[model samples]
Target chain A: MAPSDVNQGSQDDDVLQEAANWLKAGKKVALATVVSSWGSSPRPPGSQLAVSEDSTFVGSVSGGCIEGAVVTEALEVMESGESKVLEYGVTDELAWEVGLACGGKVKVFVEAVQE
Target chain B: MKTSMLDQILRDQEAKTPVALATELATGDQALIYYDSATGSLANNPEIVAAARQAIQDDKNGTVKLDAGEIYFQTFNPPLRMLIVGAVHIAQPLSRMASVVGYDVTVVDPRQSFASPERFPGISLNHEWPDDGLRELDIDRRTAVVTLTHDPKLDDPALGVALRSDAFYIGSLGSRGTHAGRTERLKGEGFTEAEISRIKGPVGLNIGAISPAEIAVSILGEVTDCLHAKEKKAAA
Candidate 1:
């Protein structure tokens, strides 16, 4: 990882700034931030993902396993304009489905990119 | 309001100022808090400001709950700093390695010739006295000070200021006997034995390093260990 990647916030901030620009351009957008995490997750709590009305996306929440689901929910959030928190846990059965080999829990807070 | 808040935050980050963003998750309300100024439009809530400021001082990021709501206090601090008080052979690799690992490194020495831009390109070079240079830099918890110049005139003054400040790690390069002499000198300079003990003489972990580059690696390892240890303690 680059030195900038170590802090995660700085990297996420750049993504958020880009999202804000996209929002200003009249593109509907939603932001998903990992508010909390448990066990040996690859990404830290402040990791982020931004999704747009056109299905454009930036950043990552689960590295891979749950991004597709989060982006799906983010598109819905952009349409509904209601913010929600999402929880994903890697259980034996769920892991098999999501392709997550490790056991951990991550809670992501999703909200519309307001203003 | 949202545009300006984000703008101010980006500005602060560009200036390397310490700041925090407090968001009430329930309501989606947000505020940008500046640590040094303690000034923000964050709902005029003293509890939130206090909590956010504490997190800023600690330089750690997390969320906290209050009667008002669950506020996520995300802190933004300046990059970690490494002040090497000698522009010597060890510092060449040390500064490069430190910078690679995300530290804003500054090499200080009174010898302008040694502290030239040619010797250490792409790094901040300070040709002022060690003590004055450190004072100008304003050593903080995020900074680590290491004095590689064995000359008392150079290293002692740097050590003096570092011991008094909150700089997380302080190390001096010397042999065991030299460190003993330095201990006595520091005692004469009015530092207590406990304070003097803070100086990690024979600096770096005991990896039996001999070459200057190898020594730099050892020192970097020790500095990294110290930083992580402090983070662990704060988390606990």
Candidate 2:
């Protein structure tokens, strides 16, 4: 599928629908959901992002501090068809570079979109 | 399977009913859980079904780790609704304030003149009698009913319907003397003291509000307080 399809569907509705659209378009997709969040997290739990095999993404797991990392992880999960839970926090080594300065933690669960 | 579950969830979202979808992350197996008596489980797992039902009742979304696998319970409940029983002076600002705070506001008054779109601007208005209007609105636990008519004939029937339903907040505009009289009437109509006490007479937080707008603020504030107060109780 074209990268524009991913972009267009990203802002359409919820992340689940975006992922479903991408899948129906024959795009390999993975889903990243914020399963948990600590203090000061911009989005609450159950927030999601849809990531295609081509690295295009939709929605957000963080305010903007961690989408790139989640996309990278999601691409890897798409390859292996495996689910993994990733954690990000202010105490991480790359926290400053990722802009997680609000002293909070979030856990994102990423899985290959397979029905 | 995902398509079926997603379709069901989308249907439930459109219908504005509380629905819980649980997915086993490991196997990608999913189920739709409805707490209602019929067809309660889709995944056929009792424990997971119970967890989903509990999540819906608690009005929360989270994960439940079972021996079978980790199931993510995605809950979709409709937005709260505020039904203003009278298109009186207070409802003008109250409807606006309620909408600002994320309530699907609907004003019901049989008086067509008072219930005009000119008075309410963009609100959903019902020009039917109070009881019939409330019946059509289908009050639920996520609904809040406020009667501002102050007229016993209009307010009483609305109050009877609201009190018997599962509306989270039921308030009526009246003074202390009026409330006392209302209590007697409700008692005479077979309402127990416990049920009658649920009505917040002199509706709204006692902020000494004077103007209609001020009273609307106090009422919205009290409605918010009631909502959160219920949440606190559920959390505890």
Candidate 3:
């Protein structure tokens, strides 16, 4: 898909639709939620985006800090329909080694969406 | 043969039943599901199917996005909850605002003085202790909790619950001084430096707000900021 298409579908509503498409197609899917945020947190507690088996991006839990990780986590839940919690900051190593440079930390919970 | 989840939320809203939206953020199959009081945790209810269709239609017609064909929010199980820890002055307006924005708002407080259905107007009122009351409401990633009470009696316990609970947007209302006091109290109560940091003190954007209504706007603004910032990062 083109970058523009990805960008265009990145809206929250559109992203949800992508997830819905996957569910309808009987593909394993997962949902990620931002349970907590601190510092210059990008999203609030309840902001959401959906993704699908194809890695077709839809919604977002974090801006970019952990999308890669979230995708990986989502895949795991998608298959087993289990729920998991994740935490992230500006930089993974920095967040772990020193502290969150952005001052805020976000906790995301990923779960397989049972439809 | 199907009503959409979005449609069910609408129906629930109209019927004075509460419903929440669950969106998936990563690359995996995502779908929207509604939690109902009766049917319990079933997904793909007729309402969900219909609402999903309408939500997609709204995206197609709405200016948010097009050309991308349609917009679908992710799918998740029921219990996408929104819990407000205080039904204080600002909460009245905040509840109204959240509803207009399509959030299912539950006004919770142990104080009868602050939490009343009359004061909250269209919002759901829960007159239970903050910690205990949260049990009735769903606290999850898709759920956002905001504390509108400035009283320690109300705010502190809610913060304690929120810190340990999974609800998102755990913010309290107060000035810098009040927030500082809260920090001290949370620390005294044994919250780690890290946990206390999660609280958005002097809550909302520093937009020089002074009224409950204005504060409501600012609070939601900050909440959106939290929401979009994460989304922006994810997209990048």
Candidate 4:
């Protein structure tokens, strides 16, 4: 079996459904997906994190190492209505500051869900 | 990502339909790619459409470089499935183990007493004959077929159907002698040796397993090995 992760198949479905429900409830939502990963990454490509306007989040892009930064970018995406990609690697200064200490790298895409 | 598009993707997922979402990085334009159709703003881009189709076939998420920038293809495939033909002792632990590994499991046994809701709670149970039940379930490439009955009456019919299907893994629980007998039977029934070779007889890894649960572990391990064998080859 593939390495176990909290954000597996069914959980991913739940995240997307929750994002849709939050949208129906009048909350702005942004979705962050791990577009690519390299080395001992906590999550594989396609792992996702859904964030609402108020910063309520579901799912994960990493073990919890880079979610804060992703959520921060996600809020900006919700505001701007434009998608953006963010890259983080253990070698980056920002990555060290954010504590992605697992010696892995990931590229995340953040986009707003428009009606 | 429009709410309607997201909803449609979720609907496809619920229906176990394989789909891919292609997003153009520069413009944030998106397209939904199905096996034979494409939709959304970037639907007309032949390059992106082809790449999306390839991604779906590969069952992998990836990026395609374009002159403009890049297109990200995220594939959503249906969960893997396991069809256990016989609610025997090994089936009990095997079903639970397979479920934990993310397979949508179905237990098939014609005997109601063996395939009871009590025996396989929360499992999809089919009391039809093995061949009929397997036909109804519609085995696909993502399915694994395991015949644990050991009884030729039950296991043989299931093996017949499974051999003709596209199931990625096919196994029968038995000894070498039993498997040899099975090979002869299948040959008499007109099955080619190559086709008969696909069944992993004396099934599971040779881990020296003796107990039912231990045997289940070895089978699951072998199943996992077969499931990822292609990717491992590619990586190599």
Write down the DockQ of candidate 4.
0.36
TM-score of chain B of each: 0.85, 0.79, 0.68, 0.89
Candidate 4 per-residue C-alpha lDDT over B1-236 given as tens digits, one digit per residue, 9 for 90 to 100: 99999999999989989899999876788999998999999989888888888888877775668754688888888888999999998999999988888789999999999998888888899999999999999998889999999999999999999999999999999999999999999999899999999999999999999999999999999888888777567545
Tens-place lDDT digits, model 3, residues A4-111: 111111224444556667777876666666645555766655455566787766677666656777887788777776566677755656335422445567767676
CAPRI-style grade of the A/B interface in model 3: incorrect
- Provide the lowest-lDDT 10-residue window in model 1 chain A: A1-10
* Model 2 lDDT per residue over A69-94, tens place: 89999999888887888888784565
* Model 1 residue-pair collision total: 0
Residue-level lDDT tens digits of model 3 in B124-217: 7888888778766747665678887788987788788888876557788788999999999999999998998878888889888888899989
List residue ranges in candidate 2 displaced over 4 A: A1-32, A37-44, A47-84, A88-106, A110-115, B1-8, B26-29, B33-46, B96-104, B117-124, B136-138, B175-193, B206-217, B233-236
- Return the lDDT, model 2, position A77: 88
Residue A52, candidate 2: how far off, in angstroms? 9.2
Error of 1 at B101 (Å): 3.0
Q: How many pairs in model 4 have backbone atoms within 3 A of each other, for residues 3 or more apart or on separate chains, i.e. clashes?
A: 0
Q: In lDDT terms, which candidate is top? A: 4
Worst 10 residues of 2 chain A by lDDT: A1-10
Runs of candidate 4 with Cα error greater than 4 angstroms are: A1-11, A91-95, A99-102, B175-184, B187-194, B205-217
